[model samples]
Target: MRNICAIIVVFFMACSIPGYAQPRHSFALGDSVFLLDNRPFQMICGEMHYARIPREAWRQRMKMAKAMGLNTIGTYVFWNIQEPEKGKFDFSGNNDIAAFVRTAQEESLWVVLRPSPYVCAEWEFGGYPYWLQNENGLVVRSKEQKYLNEYKQYLMALGKQLAPLQVNHGGNILMIQVENEYGSYGDNREYLEINRKIFQKAGFDGLLFTADQANDVARGFLPGSLPALNGIDNPQRIRQLVRRYNNGKGPYYVAEWYPAWFDWWGSPHHVVPPEKYTAQLDSMLSAGISVNMYMFHGGTTRGFMNGANYNDKSPYEPQISSYDYDAPLDEAGNATPKFMAFRSVIQKHLPPGQTLPDVPAAKPAISIDDIQFRETTGIFNILSSPKINQRLLTFEDLHQAYGFVLYRTKLNGGAKGKLAVMGLRDYALVFINGRRAGILDRRLGDSSINVEMPQGSVTLDILVENLGRINFGPYLLNNKKGITQKVLFNNQELENWQMFSLPLDDINAIKRSAAAKKYTEAPVLRRGNFNLVKTGDSYLDMSRWGKGVVWVNGYNLGRYWNVGPQQTIYVPGEWLKPGNNEIVVLELIKPQQAILRGIEKPSLSN
Candidate 1:
């Protein structure tokens, strides 16, 4: 009787435990469908990025995904965040992608990893390191040997962390993606083939697939690999596209179905109603088509990691710090109406006797009001020594990736006309002798400003901010922040400038001023502290503040502007301590009030 009880216990354990009890399984791409352990499987996946979400909240987010009836989680591997500098790789802390995948498996979910070296997820430089621009004649997302070598090095390093997790290796990773949406970039079949071989050599020995728009499948498709579609919602269209690309076979997959959209600064917040896509989602599932939501959750594009978009159709539109893509799960991992809409559709399609787990509770939120600044200092107070040069050097030339840079020069007495920075990358604040002059914004195509100088040798300072590199379209290669061209005064080139690198990666290194300086239009750093008795997910409302960046406890919480769209910065409670938590703000423009507050919910709009 004891032996019988033991056998029954083991049987229940195997049946109930999510991933712990499952044995090693085989996942293969048959001619018609995906087979998991010799049985046809439909992948209901949701896209989430590890870099966007805080490391502490990864497990809870994955559990949320499982409860939403998602059998798989899709994620993009950002190369820039992983390898900030050439040959220096960091795969720990928030970047511990191996841990992210393991947690997904622990929640009984498979992973479809998109480790494309060039991922245009509206991330900076399309995931290419800014230093890549410094390489001589190296074109990214091409067959350029210099770019290819760097790509291979990054892929190999990343594979070391994830390749072993493939399903065949007793891990939950199902397949790996090649170069992302290459069809939209170029019709380089040769480059696509090279990318495929690189993945195999890197030890990814599972089904490899290429995802593209329906029309792009022909160009981005490589022989002997699955062709997945993106944004194609119609069931018949999906089947037709997959069949055409897969030699008249099956296994139709929609890799990126965008239920909603991402927003940019100065634009209205993008919110799509659940009714728009609910019917399509239900139809797709009823037809047995595998689908992956573009962003199940877009946590946040914290720090200077946000990317921008530039082309003929639109002006320079930099992505806001909040990556809340209006997804099923909101920015703070709270399930939305859209979540239930998608979950309802996904739940109906589950196999016989299979049921989704209960949805986890939303992360707790606490509010703190009337946070006051204890100290303030000028932007120049934080500057170190300057690199004086004849010609203006870019941020990359000075070995700086993100953040602001100061370009200072002395104009001779009465030496002023239309001050023109020929190629101002993004935005710049002009000052004359410690006084705010005018603004040169790339978004407005304002490079030259009419100015009159005093009859003394006054100092000219142009503080340029890297809004974000161009992430999409043909202008990607031309992304170099700071003054890329000659600075001209009245059409004559200005020279002998002093360059200061303000790569504010270490906010703690900044020493606050002993006395509070008089608040002016010039940029200033405001420091404050707040004690938290309890900690949870919260948003720091920047509605009362002007243009600036925020840092809580030492983590850079990205940028905030009075501009419409995103008005709060997400502060993960894990980054906070129960005692005194420090808060720092670098305000470019003087706000009416130096007061801030921690609000329970996010105020994404103006």
Candidate 2:
């Protein structure tokens, strides 16, 4: 046994040397533990989404994970961003899962791929393609043939890029997870079985596993495959549960050991002190229970990629743009004190003479004060071609996926009462004759507002914003944006609508005029410019601004709301240039000042 251990360490060390040919090793499930190259292997992993991190920072993030004493990297494949449009696939840039895995290999790390068709990682539509909702009678994450067929097609397409990288194919991927946390959604064993088969068909010929909370072991586990626990720490109970499913043998694994939790828009930023989890981690390590930290480093969710949560208990809680997850690493990829605590605990459990790598040096950060907005534009000024209809059409109905939509109609005179929007999916700004009337937010359960119509015909426009799609619980399938149904004036149904799909795919295309000296609640785009001597990571403080999205050099920096919790947007230095850089903000509400500032550190609070 000692000889085998020495050989494994030497082999890995050799693989780390430059110009060395990376050798593939076997990863198999033992009676009670994982076997790598016929030796017991304890998998220490960290979850980090490649899409959430900038492509330029992938290597640096991986190095940070390695320095934190992680041997494995876990990631989920988001279907929405991978295939934004039906049949149109993008595997390059940040969507490059293959490159991400290969980079993990370059760092001498193995990977656990969770290629989820429905990953409830607080991602938009739970990582599902928006086009799926357009299919009639297609129930997602189910046995519906339409959904299944689409699922299979997408998996196969993704397989072409990633399946060949599995461990069995001499790649670094050690295990591939089945559908993510299915027990929380359903108890259909057949649905899981179908998913397992689809993974195999997609060319993942490596060890397979299913992860669910402790109580969901029976409901979520795939028979004849490795069963892993999520959010569980009790060693005795973990062993008992795994043995019962493994025919009285062992290999206890906690797939998601959360050190900290994620935050939503209106809530306080979540933080778990290092003291709270260091002991649990030590206990698990001493018991040889392989563990994967849920998020070793939670990066930012750029663009309209951030998702929302909905259920009977909670109102619509949209996730903040900064995924920051409050994990061991901060949002900008800087190691936190929690990282040090975890590293110390992990180092204590390492084999004799084996040392964790030195922590990477902190990246430089820059701050700019008062970036001036010299130009402006409004939603009304930048209208697109509209689709005319008697009734309203949804974002999907017009083949749109994200951003804002404008619904315009002429209101006949002498009509005055409560303006009710039936099935307003998220939020809308009501306008009467080019003036702000009121606002309706689904988060507040607001469906209508009292309005008095003018004596003559007046233009009525409702600009609806897709806050984010429901990313978890039973509401995953109920994801359609921008007014899913009818709008009413008093109890009378309103008609003759012209719908403008504002996907906001390209912010740079929008023409801008001179900046407004004053402000209004109407949706307006403000442009600012700042010069830099050298580019480094920084946070754009949007605390003074109202609810809206910002773009740096045309790269959508994500959304910001004055709502408590997240106050600054993480601006990756790679997005900035040494000379002049442009910043654009689409403010939905008025602000006290038109000025913005860049801070060196993230202020994820109100």
* lDDT by residue (tens digit), candidate 1, 144-214: 99999999999899989988888887789998999788888888888999999999999998989999998
Q: Which stretches of candidate 2 lie over 4 Å from their true place?
A: 1-22, 513-520
lDDT of each: 0.88, 0.87
True-structure RMSD, every candidate: 3.9, 5.4
